[model samples]
Target: MPPAKKETRPSSRAGRLRAPAFVKNHRGVKNWKEAGAWLEWRGIEDIECITPDQAGIARGKMMPSKKFTSNTSLALPSAVFMTTISGGYPEDGNGFSYPEDDGDLKLMPDLGTLSEVPWETDPTAQVICDLVHQDGRSVEFTPRNVLKRVLAAYSERGWRPVVAPEIEFYLVRKNPDPDYPLTPPVGRSGRPIGGGAGYSIAGVNEFDELIDDIYHFSEAQGLEIDTLIHEEGAGQLEINLRHGDPVELADQVFMFKRTIREAALKHETYATFMAKPMQGQPGSAMHIHQSVIDTRTGRNLFTNEDGSESAAFLHFIGGMQKHVPNALVMFAPYVNSYRRLTQAASAPVNTKWGYDNRTTAFRVPRSDPAARRVENRIPSSDANPYLALAASLACGLVGIDKKVKPDQPIGTTANEDEIDLPRGLLEAVDLFENDKDLRAVIGDPFVTTYAAIKRAEFETFMEVISPWEREYLLLNV
Candidate 1:
């Protein structure tokens, strides 16, 4: 039998009692004029307009409050969306290249994503933007736009996806040298963490100050963060956000990552969301829990009125099982991401589904009929949250539309003989590039661009000689 569900506490202790009036009313500063006015009202002097690049990293300009609203839109080069994770152009030219010269694109503020930069020393604010072509259509390669495209598909089907993300990361002592291994930061007790402390209240208290600041910053940014717990890795923690619209949840996850990094810096530590940052430790992941609801009745589409599992639910699982192998590039994009997927690493390595089974890629958590959902455990923390959420939802939609039926759910344990996931970035990229159905749903342009970027990153990684190679192969071989 599946483990019994436990009542979880709200993650934001500060916002749990009651939220401030300003926070309640702040539904993202809606337009250029409204954003400017909100910044002015908050005594903010600088405003940063950011858009997620192909790698999910924020790239944008910081503008003076006075000059920002004067222009209707921010113009940037189209090439910005095609840059590799290492800040270099792809070997085979970015597909968006113009014959004459680099083309220009526009940045339109997504007013719903405006939030104050709580960790900044100066009065500053930031808003996420949507990349738009000169023709006024959204840029196909942008991570945010990709998510919007998938969400639009759901809307056309009279369905909406609700998503909640569980983000895991580690706090370590600040280290500038790439050669040195990271150590857990010294907590309030002035002792560095020595081993894994999953679910230990004492572990949480040790880093109370940093965790507290994270809560405050999350509250200020209006991120609906809900539960906090110590994960299985030393100094690792997980934050759970309440479920809501897929787009809104993606935006919140994007901001929440930046917030945690900034807060860690302020507390004299460093935070890394890398999938596997340390040897002999569990890796961090961005586990996405998802459900769909009817647009008209707002009823849970995964559950039937008779309280049994719905066909839509099983078909959704089937879709994920069939399509996840092709979408592996989005879930584990980096060279380091695959290191976390090893057996016994608390990461899923196959597209098996089970009832509350942690070893499976898809797990159906025990919940009430209305809350029935699927938890995709494949994506790592290093993944671009926008792309990951979009891909996951798109797969489920494909299953529902085609009426795909999943095989019987694994009871307790996943089959050891099940097929393994792509072993590395190269394999995953190949799978993504070759999959026709996945490309159709996630856009051909995005699939091509993303695969190129990951290929470039993988090639760069291949050129490096690690210490392990020198230690083992140099003398012996």
Candidate 2:
């Protein structure tokens, strides 16, 4: 029999918020008139106001250039916050009531995120937004809002968190069949990539056109992408971004995903940030390098004036070691994400910190005292950048506040007896739901909502039958 046909659900726009009649037609120049003038001067015709959903997907509406820049805020359905990764509403079944049923929330644009859409056929611009309720309260479940809350916590302590992300992804041929494995796209050499090519310069040149376009798009979007290298898996590549504010880096990473995918499509290839896209190959990861800076004197809080490691540094690592098990849901968000955390995949399965060691989840890279930082190697490329950064920073802040001291750093692979992180989505979700301190730090409302959504997704996924079950269990069991 032929494979089952996939569901033809309407695009998310069906459930999206509709503009009020007054604002829909009346596009009078107003609060952000200067922004409108600038877009008009640049010949931009449309603007996309984007919000990061719970699943890290960008959702929003495009408006005429004038309307977008003139309006102080864009309103969206409150239900947007409650959307599950599968694009389904909550299945609790008692009426499906949520904030959107009552009203809509305004999306306030972050002016700093304004950028031209270099890949679009038309003259278009895009900006990231933060969701705000009608009464001016921030929406807690939105990934961006969660990150902002974490940043605010750091601010209260008179410190700023800097983050740099090393993103890895794959370039695969477009495969429409669900049962077939994806193959690498044909490069300029007229051959599909095979086997490992870690750090191979020839492997990079094989698809220089795609790389060049990615660089152009990154520059246009103001993304601080520093280096690109071939990774261990075929058609896999990693790009490192320059470290800066946590929120800014998250925004850049979010935009970078869109940029890379668009460039790939233009070249008739596909780009995926999926945690484990192929079997028997190393998985992609979004490794984050983080550090804290004192607001008063601009000194590295992780290091002392004499260039020795400070107590704060130890506390930061201690906090990560303490909280990472519970925060695993944020780092490895999906079921496929757990598949990438195995021993042979070169992914960290335990929260062990060490100096310049990739085997440990957290590694303190060799750098000058001024550049002291911790590299969180647990998050998968599929993880939401905002939530991952927020969880990491929040845990480190907890360490700083509690003065948690870390154990001795390991110089090699962590012992098999070290603390193991959550093995799968169910365990991670249960841990996240029950961790009171983490819920408080990230926000109780978001924790509750996110847990519900993930649980629903897990249930839905469990219902689907896989080829392995049919091939092995069908004949025997």
Q: Write the per-residue lDDT of candidate 2 for residues 1-477, one digit (tens) a residue.
A: 111222222235542233222222112222253355446444678989898898788999899875664424569887777877887766543223365364788888876677788999898888888998889999887899999999999899899999999999999999888788888778889988975799999999988999999999888776777899999898999999998999888998899999999999989999999999999888999999999999999999999999999999999999999888899999999999998988644898887899998888899999999999999999999998999999999888888888888888889777344448888898898898877777778997788777877777888899899989999999898
Question: In model 1, which residue pairs have backbone atoms overlapping below 3 Å?
Answer: 11-226
lDDT for each candidate structure: 0.83, 0.83
Q: How far off is residue 8 in model 2, in Å?
A: 46
Weakest 10 consecutive residues of candidate 2 by summed lDDT: 19-28
TM-score, prediction 1: 0.92
Report the C-alpha lDDT of model 1 over 407-467, residue by residue, as the tens digit: 8888766635445789888888888887777777789788777777787788888888999
Error of 2 at 239 (Å): 0.7
Query: For candidate 2, what is the TM-score?
Result: 0.91
The lDDT, on a scale of 0 to 1, for candidate 2 is 0.83
List the lowest-lDDT window of 10 residues for candidate 1: 1-10
Residue runs of model 1 more than 4 Å from their true location after superposition: 1-27, 31-33, 93-100, 415-419
* Candidate 2 lDDT score at position 123: 86
Backbone clashes, candidate 2: 0
